[model samples]
Target: MKRKQPLLLVIIAFFVLSNFIYNVPNIEAATKLDIKAKAAIIIDAKTGKVLYEDNADELLGVASMSKMLTEYLVLEAIHEGRISWDQKVTINEFVHKLSSPYLGLSNVGLTQGEAYTVKELYQAMAIHSANAATVALAEVIAGTEGNFVKLMNEKAAELELGDFHFVNSTGLNNSDMLDNHPEGTDINDENKMSARATAKLAYHLLNDFPEVLDTAKISRLKFRDGRTYNNFNWMLPELTFEYEGVDGLKTGSTNFAGYCFTATAVKSNQRFITVIMNTKSQIERFNETAKLLDYAFANFGEDTLFEKGFVPESKKTLPVTKGKDDSVKIATKDPLSLIIKNGEKDKYKAKLVLNKKKLNEDGQLTAPVKEGDVVGYLTYEYDGDDLGFITDKESTVKVDVVATESVEKANWFVLMMRGIGNFFASLWNGITTTVGGWF
Candidate 1:
């Protein structure tokens, strides 16, 4: 009885400890960061992998951040030869009135009947967030701001920027446009895009037209090496709230939009794009952005799970029917590299998925396969909590898998002989099976 009492107490204590240990949440699992903004997101600039998000899908006014779309179109036109940097754009009466300093809008004072080079207006728009400069460039490209609005929406759709509506090129409220608003939009309508869409726009802009950064990073804009203005992005070097590696992005604000910013930074060879919409103040936006950038740079890093030409042991070879060679080796078409959370590098599993449509009934590929023919994909499954990509809800990161070498079709005689040999082998096996069953 005495011994039983001690054992019973021990069991009770163990049960209590076990329950406490399991029921208590993991500290790591509780690491959901709270960002004080209406919408915010952080993504890997290279891979579009979303690192963190808070109400990122909510539609809200992007303010001057809307000019990023305009910037993309302008850069695209230049690249396609439709426009040139040296090409001059003439300012009109509407843009002149809109750009007037007395109207309480951000502008560099464009004069009506005066012409500025595409490069000059782009500098004003990109560096100062000048509303009139943006509109002038729009007019030069599309003949009217309303027509430019259509081109903006069309290009937005082409870029797959989901949940976006552009009513103007400069991102100002139509009422602010002083009744010279686009033809199709209501007088009060404003340019709106979700934080995810905004980040994607920045991604495409930086990726497609990298030269925009060359201008965006310029803290002081010099026109004719004389007139100058401060860049709107305060996070740039030597500016207020300046953060290391922050350069070449846009900032936005309006009475309705509060303060918004799309910022990109590079540190330790890793680049991250962050967006915060509707923060309480201009400074608060950069502060919140700093937290996101800190989290990204501190917690995430680029990792290569597999090198190019890596073949999964389980699916290293694929059978090729009617080919000079009976089989072909398969491998990853490129290195499987992506941004990954720190300390979770080994938690990813690789899988080889073959294309079913290209295979015959026996699961064999037809001959005449070319080298580097994409037959399938090499996908990775992460074992940890995945925030998912901003571009889509695809849970796995994937790369193409292709044939390591080409396989020529077998000659007719060689194929016929092979078919005959298979038939005889099958017949012999069936006959032996029946004779064995009789015994």
Candidate 2:
């Protein structure tokens, strides 16, 4: 009967252990985001958390902001040694036409016969929105805008920008084409960019070409031998509205796109990405963004939602019998984080529950146990509702469950003892083996 005490305790402990593990993560300490915009999303660039958002996946034309992608591709070429900053590019009619509403010029005063460095022309495209420079760089990279666009589409597909479709490197609506013109003749990518994707693209751009920001950060940049163009993104110099961290990206204001802006700000050791579309006025774009930025900086501070190797002990590390290895350590393949509401930091919580019996036996698990293999799953509950499985929320975070180690069975004596021992001994051995791991 004394032997029965521990065995009874094991059963009681099993049931009790789950009681604490499965309850909702604490939420009395979290904050909520207060945002009002046609479309908006605020994400923590470090952990890729979608801090706040609206219509993040909705298609929207980004206008000049499309240049963010262009900048990424150009910088990619430069990094790959495809072209140098000083390489001379011959001027053409397309380069000449850049003077029209492109380079902030009705027409840039480029002489019919002249050559410019790849660096100078690109600066005009990036800073001044020079159409000619866009075409020139496209030609240099792939010999034609059409080819470069093919490259653009390929990159889009690779980045999984499902809502993305690139018809021209310039992102202009080609009136010459379009069998069905009733789509309102929207220029550029036609569909508006969601607040989330803008954030994703901005994050990608910064990671890809920080140098672009170096130039975009410039309040006033000059080109074309004399004509100077000020950044249309007027938030740079504590400007008329005090856009302190306001840096470069692209701004669009076609009748259809209606003042699109993708803005990034860094303060308090945390960086934020915001996208606002179809604002009533250019100033509203700046004003709304400033409000968003201020809220993010003041109300939201950085939290380590995920560290490269932070696996809470709650993750499943099941014991195993004889096999190729000793034990199996499983964890969520992807790093997890929270994009909590503006004021709800303390309210954020996580709980891990292991699905023990469901895991296969034969003292074996299914093949393909990656380092981050998930033997079980964890649910992320915000405010006490089951969020189901946390797959890709915005399709940006990538992760897969991998097995940390292969499980080899215990020695013959241990297995024999496991079979003969009533229950407590088996339980004790399982715990020790699971905790101590393979010898």
In order of listing, the candidates' clash counts read 0, 31
At residue 226, give the lDDT of candidate 2: 83
lDDT of 1 at 212: 86
Per-model lDDT: 0.89, 0.63
User: What TM-score does candidate 1 get on C-alpha atoms?
Assistant: 0.87
Per-residue lDDT value at 263 in model 2:
78
lDDT per residue for candidate 2 within 1-439, as digits (tens), equals 9989999999999989888788757554333334445677666666566655656677776666777777788899999999989999888765555544533431245544588888887777776666567767888888877677778778866665556656666555544223311133333334345555667777778766777778776666677668777676777774465566667566666566677777776665567777888777888788877776776776656543544344546545555544445457765555665444455545645555554553565534543344555555444446633222111453333333446665544567876766677487878988999989865
- Stretches of candidate 2 off by over 4 Å are 1-37, 100-109, 175-192, 304-317, 320-339, 342-346, 351-381, 384-439
Candidate 2 overall lDDT versus native: 0.63
For candidate 1, list the clashing residue pairs, or say none.
none
